[model samples]
Target: MRRKLTLKDVSRESGLSTFTVSRALAGAEGVSKESREAVLRVAEEMGYVPNLAAQKLRGVASSTIAVITAGTSNAYYLDMMNGIQAVAQDMDQTVVLTDIAIGGVYDIGRERQTIQRLLEGRVGGVISTLTLLPESVKRLEDWEIPIVFVDSSPPEELPYVPSVTTDNYNASLLVGAHLQSHAFQDWLLLVYPPIWSSRKERERGLRDAAAKAGATIEVVEAGNNAASASKALRDCLGRRGGRLPDILIAGNNPILLGAFQVARERNTIIPDNMAMVCFDDFPFAPYLDPPVTVLNERSEEIGRLSAHMLTEIMSAQIEARKAGKPAAPIYTNEHQLQVPVDLVVRRSCGCPDPTRSRS
Candidate 1:
């Protein structure tokens, strides 16, 4: 039997994205006139028809959970995702992942579109890696879909919203203390933007730590990618009379990679020329030419905890609905969690360990 025409077929034939095709077929907004016309032309030529029954059935998606994140360029993203998937799989729930940013560039419009798509699909729960807009949170709440944030906090206006994340302020203090131990007087922090809420905490802690240590610290903002980090660092160096700081602090794995790229380009030896450390630990940290020191955020643990919290709330909502009661999710003090982090020391921060170290 021949396969029936679907969104994928329309997308392939129209040379447009599946998202664009979906909006075009539904006569929804966000589809340009040119794209909509092309999609309609292709659907007519292919004898396409909407599968209303299938869509109606798909709308009963109480067993599906969506995980939303900014981007997934670093290895730690996999670790956290594995933990989330483990819990979801054990609960017999399907998982869907959506990235609001590609190539480490955050887009508010993309985030808005993603939330709408999830709602339209009748997702039962959401796990976000970063804070979302207030209205987006409200829509999910109004629908009674449980949401749990991982590696980031909910917006300030919704303090009761559940989250699982490291104590970033303390984590930065930990990093700062270690840098002080090495007596590094000048530190350069090349960090990503504040869209990832943790940036604010991390920066605050670093600022306080620098003051306490009597060390000079400078921050250069960059997009959340290695290429952006490289450019930012290169420009920062140019601004500083081409003099390297005593130590460089990268906010995350991608930024760390960019810092390395700049150092190598300048023939700058690790620790000898400048010490370095980063926020998240990755697989290659131990195996790098000079093993990198990093703050261990325990991403897998965060992911598992986040998924468990969302599932708990969702289970409660289901029970409430079954009992013909209000089906809003439950939130308690336990739901607002702050997991502590540890700094893993290595040669990259001027430690004299020539061998691979444990994290």
Candidate 2:
């Protein structure tokens, strides 16, 4: 049988102390770039795999981080994960993804347990898309790991963790302004419950922009699916003397998809009966019946930036610990590293249809 691959093999092959070899492979980042490459190369040649669980037993960092989100079903979430994955690959960090999609009752339980497992493994850090359990936040001080939150509210105003997100309010303002310039009078904002930060902020922005333009605005709430949104739309139209909204701002991509379904059911003409826009852009947005006017949320960039932030926080925490100082975590606000948004105008907004009008 071949000899077993171990840290001793890496240390001997790389002329570095076992500790240095360990740090290099564990993503500690204190070792010089040249030294890290040397250690990693020899370990790879020797087929030595660092055991993360064993490292945790020795109170050492794992070269892994966890990224928890609702699910991979949502295209927006998938884009965010793609961004995070790109950064993770560059940093040679492994990512653990946990999907919570059963229901609210089960989600809370799963999120907390999954986080606890990651903590016990001594993951280098964590980047979560909210849905983290309150208990996890309360016990974060004990974990002492670098943390980053994406598209969610930070817990208890903890100023140490970083957040990566889009400007929901301003994105909404762009949509409202576009409609106002078009002279669309009656507007309807169809969204899910306003409990979500994205929905609440976008609604506020829409209201502000509409008020300034002297356009009438109405709000309607839809359940999580298209069927509910369709029913809601039909009910609104029946109550309004069969008149349709001049403009419709769907709070998110799924909601917009639902609105489009409702429009089809009602046999309404796009931009002739109603104009439509969505808060977040989708992959196939340009191929729709009337290419959609979308407020691009930069979802992928949010994930990429959050990963970078976590890497920075992990580095800082390691240095502070090495210097025997308090590991003062860095909490970057949306202002410090906020992602920008763009409003892409297409045929759906009652503007001249680009396909036919451009030529």
The parts of candidate 1 lying over 4 Å away from their true place are: 1-25, 28-56, 354-359
lDDT of each residue in 1-359, candidate 1, tens digit only: 13445789989988999999988878899989999999989986875655433467774567889999887896778889999999999999999999997878999999988877776677889999989998889767766777988888898999999999899999999999998898989988999999999899899999999999999999999999999999999999999999999999999999999999999999999989998999999988998879999999999988899988988888888888799888878899999998888888989999977464667
Q: Note the Cα lDDT for every prediction shown.
A: 0.88, 0.75
Question: Candidate 2 — which residues are off by over 4 angstroms?
Answer: 1-61, 101-106, 131-134, 224-228, 238-242, 323-328, 332-336, 355-359
Q: Estimate each model's TM-score.
A: 0.85, 0.75
Supply the TM-score for candidate 1. 0.85
lDDT leader: 1
